[model samples]
Target: MVDLRRARTTPTDRPSDASGKGTRDYRHSWIVRGHWRNQYYRSRGDHRPIWIADHLAGPGDKPLIGGERVNVLRR
Candidate 1:
């Protein structure tokens, strides 16, 4: 069995310059969804399933396009 969920969602930013300052360019950015994976471990002759969370992949600086959705986690 595999279970996946969104861990967190955040806006992406441009790469920082030498001065450690980055521009807020959302035009070229896109949203990347998160997911989970399973890990098997052998302990005492038992296979344990470990759920690994994944981080959002992509430059989320750009605003969401039409019909695009993102799962935001509230603190």
Candidate 2:
């Protein structure tokens, strides 16, 4: 889950402005991995092809299903 609460500038995370008006939002939900070569993917037991990336996927992360493989189809 992304931390949407107020942030404090310290030695670690830096603020975007001098007054610290904006902080880095480290929270991530999901994103498509790799190129959008295909439109849908599905693993075993899935009723339908997953049109979107995995919910657990994040930035710089690859979309994976059951820690195995993903079947993609060209749109």
Candidate 3:
């Protein structure tokens, strides 16, 4: 069971430099056990509850349906 709500925090700038992750380091990541892949999120800093998907990792099997907002579907 992957904890989609659990976020891993890193320095916001770590992704932008030579590391090449470029903004990707600051975002949070979630792994789907069933899909065997990862999902990512970035901070909107809108002072509201929102999460932006950094990028989609898999096919239809893994998708962040709502842009900037992750809707976790539980079956």
Indicate which candidate wins on lDDT: 1
* Residues 1-75 of candidate 3: C-alpha lDDT, one tens digit per residue: 577675788665553566665544213334333322333334643344344445544344443333354678898
How well is each residue in 1-75 modelled by candidate 2, as lDDT tens digits? 333876765665565788857665545445435432333335654354334443355444444334456566664
How high is the lDDT of residue 21 in model 1?
78
What is the alpha-carbon lDDT for the whole of candidate 3?
Answer: 0.46
Model 1, 1-75: lDDT tens per residue?
Answer: 445998896747557778887764445434344544455555665555555553443466545444556567665
Evaluate residue 4 in candidate 3 and report its C-alpha lDDT on the 0 to 100 scale: 66
What is the descending TM-score order? 1, 3, 2
Evaluate all candidate structures by whole-model CA lDDT and list the values in order: 0.54, 0.49, 0.46
Candidate 2: stretches off by over 4 Å = 1-11, 29-75
Better of 2 and 3 by TM-score: 3
TM-score of 3: 0.17
Clashing pairs in 3: 15-22, 15-23, 51-68
Ten-residue region with minimum lDDT total, candidate 3: 25-34
